[model samples]
Each structure stands twice: as structure tokens, then as C-alpha cells.
Target: MQVRNRQRLTLPGCSSSGGSSGGSSGGSSSSDNTLAAVGMTKNQFRCVFNPSTNRDVLGRANTAAMIDKHWTQFTSAASQLNFRFGNLDEAAVFFGMVRHEYGGYLDDMRENCARQGVACRQYDTCRQGGNNYYGRGPLQISHCYNYEAMSQYVGVNLRSNPNALLDANNNLGWRASIAFWTRPEFNCQGTWEAVRAFPTCPAAARAGNIAAVSQRINGKVECNQNPRPANQDNRVSWIQNVRTSCFGLPRLTSNLYC
Candidate 1:
């Protein structure tokens, strides 16, 4: 799943300049101005990831145009599915997951697939020749079954052509990620429905429950550890950073770890 050293295609409006510093740390009155119908704005995104400071997996500096394009595709895909964030907190949580999942890289892939286990024989033919159905896209969708299921949801043959998720010409990556996010089915440990339930949960249940959300995403590896692992802590930190630093909201004081 790791990308070999290759010349990356120069995307429109992106420059080869180094990244900028991280965003300023402070609350903003406009933090709650986000609308589920429109998703995150370019300005808000910049607040989370300053292009000059944040670099993609490929070492390219994020740009305003790049952020805008991603937002457009993200909202378009969400609209197609008629999915909307329940509130700004939900949207912030989603971005927090995204930041931890792919580091805001559209073409990002898992660094390795050696430990991903063997592919399912039933869908063996679905692997695109030499390609492995390792993690790809925003949520790092992995495995042959997942690719097959996502293919059905997206109406695209992702199982047969897993590279489609990395297709920069279209929004397939975002679509797949959004589809996975909203799916009610189980992945590894819990159902994505649990993550989606965050917005409607009681105040106490919702308080710093990013660990509950992580349980659905990667619970087997990161959750239930007496002493939380660094990766799990990092995931929760992203949510906290986005909630407080980027969105100017109070930090969740409880259940911060899985």
C-alpha cells in the first residue's frame, strides 16, 4: 500500500514551496459558524492545518486552492449521500479523525500492508492485478471485503480497481471515506453507527468520547489498553486540538483515552 518514489503530478494551484507554521492557538467567535450543509470552509480548514506548516505524506505543502478543492469535493460527496453533520462539534470531530487518518493528503496510502493479513479468496480476483487492498483514501479503507463493499456503495469497481481511490481526477477518495463514515455496519471492533451516534448522545456520554469513536475505527489495536498507547493518545489529541485550538471550544475533560 505504500507509494513508491514517483514523481507526483503537479496539482492545479499547488506550488512546490515548503509548508507554513501551524495555525495560531486561540478560540474564535466564528468557530461555530460551520454549517453541515456546506461542510468545513477553506478558512476553517486553514485554522486546523496551516498550508505553510502542514505537509502531505508526499511532502507537498498544502495550499488554499488545494483546501478549497477538497472542501468542494467533500461537500459534493456528502450532498450526494444526503449526509449532514449534526453540529459544528460533529464536523470538528470528523476533521479530527481525518487529520489523524490521512494527514489531509488526498493521495495518502498506508505505509505498509505486510501485517494486513491475507486477502480473502472469494474476492481474490478483485485485487487489481498486483495491487493490494491496503489502506487508502481519507479513512484509510483497507482489505478486499471493504473495497468490495465500498464499490457497491459508490457504484464504482473499487474491488477490481483499488487504485480508483487514489484517482486524483475525481472525488472517489472522498466519496469512499464519507460512505465508510456513514455506514452503519461493523468494521473491526464496533459499528460506524456508534461514531455517527455522537451527536445525539447524552451530554455525559458525548463528553470526550472520541475514545468511543476510535473503538469503532481501530478498537482492536488501540482501545482497551490499561495504559493507552501513543497512537491512541495521538488520535484523541487530534480531536482535542481541533475542538479547542481550531474551533475555539472547551476541551473535553473526560474519557479522552480509549
Candidate 2:
């Protein structure tokens, strides 16, 4: 199975500015200290600054720590990925994907990989020796070619050091997610193009064309498996949860499920 970077959202204020409200979320230690000191929830302080994760998934405690540890890397990656959206509709759908993919935690990411049999192997014959490109980072990028591509894009030489994706401080993993989002693949256009297209493209997302978006990232409906575990269904459910929790959109009425 080919593992691609799927459904990574750029958090509000994490990406570059597209509108007045959506400024860069990268702040200094003092800001983080202040947020933590004030006893604010992750939703209030806005955790995972770039491509905000679901507050329920990350919670206040983990969100605060992630902000303090990986905010800089997340911001850098968000800028490159163009996480900032022109409207709330675009944000809802895009971030929905992010929440579905990462849930703002490493353990959740690992579990997803395990379910799909991705990045769990010891070695791969498809590429050079010792290239264990098991799922790492927010997007769970796999395969050696992907590692090489990400290495070139992020200037990290991931092909040589495949384990670099596991580093939270350096955040090679999140960067790989962003890199994957911007590039085109799976026969559908890139998310960058869709987000940048403004009203028209965002309208599609807002209208609940999630099936189309899934194809853009996943190549096909991997979520709708038959007779057993439903990957696509789970993804759709996460997107719905994210829309409700992160964006405060209508929980039941919104056309979130694909």
C-alpha cells in the first residue's frame, strides 16, 4: 500500500495572514507562559498554533506543552504550506483534515499507522537499504521516495536519516506533512491550489465536497472499506468532530461527513 500525506490542517493564526483575523500564531515564550499561567484551555489559547488540532483530542495539558516545544517548527511549516485561509469555511474543512490525520498527538499518529500497516515494517525493498520510511510526523509519510522528496523540500536529508521524522523538537515530521500538502499527487490537485483559489475553491469545501478533497489527498476513498474497519469513515468522522470542536460549526446539521 502506498502511504501518502493525508489530511493535515494548518491551524488558525499558524499560517501566514490572508485576512485580518488570521495572523501568524507564532509567539514568544512569554505569551506561552502567560497562556499557561492564566489557566486557559487549549481552545482558548489555541493549541498546535498551526493547523489547529481538536481541543478534545489534544486537551489543555498536551496543547500547552506542544506549543512550548514545537510552535516554532509548526509555524515554519504552516507558512510553507499556506495554512492561513481567507474564510471560515475553508478553515473548517482544511483543519478538519488536520485533526483527522494527527489529532495533535504522536500516539494517535502511531496508532493510525499501525492500523494501516504503514511505517511499521523494519526494511523496504522498494528503495535503498535501511530506509525504514514508516509513518512519521503529522502526515504519516511513508515510502523511501516520499522521504527523499521531503528531504529535498525541507532541506533535511530525510532519505539518509529516516528517523528524523520522530524528532518533536526539530519537527521534521510536521514539516513533511506541510511539504506533502503543497505538492500535487493522487491525480487530484494540491490543497495549496484549492485554498489559494479563494471563494470558489473554499466554496467547494464549505459545501461539503469532502469526497473530492479526500481524493486530492488520499488518491481514493481509503476510508470506505467494506466488511471491516472503515478508514474513510473514520476520517470523515474526525473531520466532523473537528468542524464542531475547533471551528464551532454546527455539530449535527453541517454537511461534514463525506
TM-score of each: 0.72, 0.61
Q: After superposition on all CA atoms, how large is the RMSD of candidate 1?
A: 8.1
Pairs with backbone N, CA or C atoms under 3 Å apart (clashes), candidate 2: 9-98, 10-51, 11-50, 11-51, 11-52, 13-25, 119-134, 119-135, 223-231, 223-232
**109-220 per-residue lDDT for model 2 (tens digits):** 4424443555655536345566566666665666676777677766788778876777766756666775665555412233355333322334456566666566555533
Error of 2 at 173 (Å): 2.3
lDDT of 2 at 80: 63
lDDT of each: 0.57, 0.50
Which regions of candidate 1 are displaced past 4 Å? 1-40, 107-130, 186-208
Which stretches of model 2 miss by more than 4 angstroms? Answer: 1-63, 80-83, 103-119, 122-126, 185-207, 219-229, 251-258
Error of 1 at 138 (Å): 1.0
CA shift at 179, candidate 2, in angstroms?
A: 2.0
Q: Model 1, range 1-258, lDDT digits (tens) per residue?
A: 111212222212211111111252323244324443744444455555556445554566555556556667777888887777655566667767666766444434333232223342222445446556666776777667778778866778876788788766577888887777666443422225534443322222234467666766766677778787767777777777667655555778776676
Residue 121 lDDT in candidate 2:
58
